[model samples]
Target: MEQFYTDERNVQILIALLKEHGIKKVVASPGSTNVTFVGSIQQDSFFEIYSSVDERSAAYIACGLAAESGESVALSCTGATASRNYYPALTEAFYRKLPILAITSTQDESKIGHMIPQIIDRTVQPLDTVKCSVHLQTVKDAADAWDCNVKANKAILELTHGGNGPVHVNLTTTYSRNFMVKELKRERKIERVMTYGKFPDIPKGKIAVYIGSHVRMSKSLAESIDLFCETHNAIVAVDPTANYTGRYRVPYMLVAQQSIEDENRNPDLLIHIGEMSDMAGIVGQPKSVWRVNEDGKIVDRFQTLRYVFEMPEHLFFEHYSKSLLSRQNTYYNSCMEKCNYFWNNIPELPFSHIWVAFRLHNLLPMGSVLHLGILSPLRSWGYFPIPSHIEVYCNQGGFGIDGNMSSLLGASLVHPEKLYFGVVGDLSFFYDMNVLGNRHVGENVRILLINNALAAEFHLFKQTNLTKVNEIERFLSAGGHFGCKSLDVVKHLVEDWGYEYLTASTKEDFEKVYERFITPDLTEKPMIFEVFTDVNDENEALRRMYFIESSTRYKVKNAVKNIIGEDRMEIIKKIIKR
Candidate 1:
């Protein structure tokens, strides 16, 4: 058997880092400088290599592979103009935000000014083509190997950090025909940990735990987080999709509704857990953020990430909480006060999507699951509190309206004994309506479709930029896609698919029929409760909710103005609003 491997320490380290990061796909173009790299990786069973003679075509092939597989793809080429051939495809990948790793092999930098074959400067204007670039020098000692390892790790990680994009690694080879090493050396793995090898010291100040869209936590994990918050005088900030039913749960809507003068609400240390959250802007920014996730990549969603703890969240919290001294509950109390203030003063809403959610809040059975559609439904339900036993889920990872209903149906199949309620907009419900005809759907599923006849998200002032544009309804809002203001087709289709269809257009109609839809015993089949509301009422209800949470100065001015005559208070009200 032919011993197929490279003895070059830097090339071996680069390949080791690529395998460690789970980058398996390689598109190798014909290159003499990269013979050691291409030859070494080809013999390894960990990588899947594709041959492309043209460097330009190989770059595009890597792009397609990365886009389709949703994984990072590496492209290798020789030095000089072969590396230049990658510019067109790299520029395309940069603008599209695709993760492509461009590995260009070249001769030593000392030969760049001389008349050496295939020697070119690869560092000229690097950021114009890729997000970052790293130079891996030939390793001669342990220090050189360590430096190469660090640079290689950083170059691979930059492919997905902050946002996904292409990155470059220029490897200098000496053209040594040393292929005698049968096995690679054990490489050093660099783990970036905040509290390395010991418990973390809890900072004494306002600390906030912001949980994003996550699945239901285990009881042990939840208890550990709860104890951590209690011991440190921290508040757990959660949106509806967080599904954290612990004692320290504080909905982020309360914080968003408050005025900026309440600076005490800001956290000195914000600890982030879980995945992407739709309430990024709604939650107040922290002075510094410490992220805890298993992936261990640096994620600066808040733009103030000071530390990243790479471990299981439960282990980190349980260990850190053990080192804490009991502190005064100033932060927790302040957050709860604002939450209670909003809970007590919730205005009576009209027959809108939010109104329906509020009316059905208490009726949702315990030990059930609620799946909210993106945008409108998720935002609406985030304002209210759910029962501790009720688990919440949303497709906020993609944040698209495409798979809401289908995902709810899939969840219902797995937990057939538990009740599953999905609240979606009309566009979302109809887009995945074919899932209802599948044979696997059970009677435990209940869908609440809020048909506003258009994409109402476009009209929200806080959510979209199209609020100021003319004819927004025609193009951006996707108006008239599912038919205009008619549920006859929907009713006929659902009834034919063995579903019990219910429609409620007014408050009285909703009150009479909502109880039947929510009752598990009464619903013999999967039900669709279609509620009709217009865009104007929906927008007004949102505005009214914000007004209810307005600053004390605005509330006092409005109260005094309402007490006096309407005509005299108009100008003062405009000034106060401004």
Candidate 2:
């Protein structure tokens, strides 16, 4: 009779689990400790095994195979320093998110301190090298067999779970020489599904969808989302970059401004979609966040991620929306009411970046596109509503000041006929000043450069901690990095590049030249409207805006303080106390 493979129970259980999960490709490196595993699987015609003498080359081969085949590949190696050779390739797989499984066979770990020649403790790999690590116990009895089977399944499943990466399974074997087992032992198989196979039941409670920076959605997807919001009594909150023009788009600025006290506006189930968003500063605290993405990774942006629905956004929203009863629009109405109230009660002030945004909010031509810089410019314009036809774009992806002008220039190239306006702070403007010299800049591109002489964000009230640091002027705020602070430096540069340079220092100067800058009539050259404002007025304008968004009591107190002046109000308070 023909001799069969080894009857080692742990090896049999692991092989059975691997086959059950449809893992058919096994890359085996020559070794003694893994002889039983290799020899057994080699006999099983179900697996197509490839032999490699070098463990390092074997790992790269498996990575290539998994990448091309779009299937998980398993690499098996013997004990000693053989598994260490997999470090370089495994590190590449980990970073690339390739699903490679490294199965290292060894003698009992207890033999490590005994100076056993061929044993190395691979209890753990380097940090983030693998998604997870599992140590398989020797299968001696039914309990041990079941534990081994479960662990093997878990290790394999983890290879493609959450975010795909490599996983390690260190199997302990006794080197049994019995090679007469004809049939492998039957074992239970565990399967994990990251994507939704069917529509899950919608959670009962207030549901809200928060969309981050995303490209424009198709009309059908927008309509479906709108229907979902209508049917489920849900609202879709978005920052300006969300690019969604759906009816359910809530006034996020008002919601963000009132986030401190709006308990009802907070969603019990917050479904987050899209990429990163800067609206975390504005949205109310959520009780739970359910992230929907194809990657299925657990992204806890709100510190309340309970479920990760790994699927396309439209499918998840459409399915979940169908299973809900309609909810009241009270939350939506309250948000709009507060937004209207703030817009009406905003205080007019001295010339500043925000003051320009307030004045030009209604004046921006219909159907024009607005591109804003990352920090101060984006935040300032977000307070006012833009025409629905007007699309807004910003560089919040890397959130750096380096590419603001370059990105706006690229967009202008695509739509040369459409008017494009970019609002940028002086730091961002100067960082990408070379783009201004580009020959492709057309007459349709207009820029609003807010030159406050320094990085005003470092001087905001909330950033008081940064301001307290020593040498903040040079290091933190980037003061005096460029030459002397004046528009003369900018004027000389832009005039040589064929730009219509316009300067505004006071409101009178701004009103005189602002109309010509915003006019739809195309200019012979691209224009640069540089508005110079004092740092103190910019800080005070921001503080007063926050006070306006505060509670009714604060609004009343601010009004009284403005009417009576600060010194007289303090004196009256002291007199009342006496």
Instruction: Report the lDDT tens digits of candidate 1 across residue range 342-455.
Output: 778788887798888788877788788999999889888887877767888999988899989899998998978888999999888878888989999899998999998899
Off by over 4 Å in 1: 1-191, 194-200, 258-260, 549-578
TM-score of each: 0.66, 0.67
Off by over 4 Å in 2: 1-158, 161-196, 258-260, 323-328, 481-483, 549-578
Model 1 TM-score is: 0.66
| Each model's Cα RMSD | 14.9, 13.0
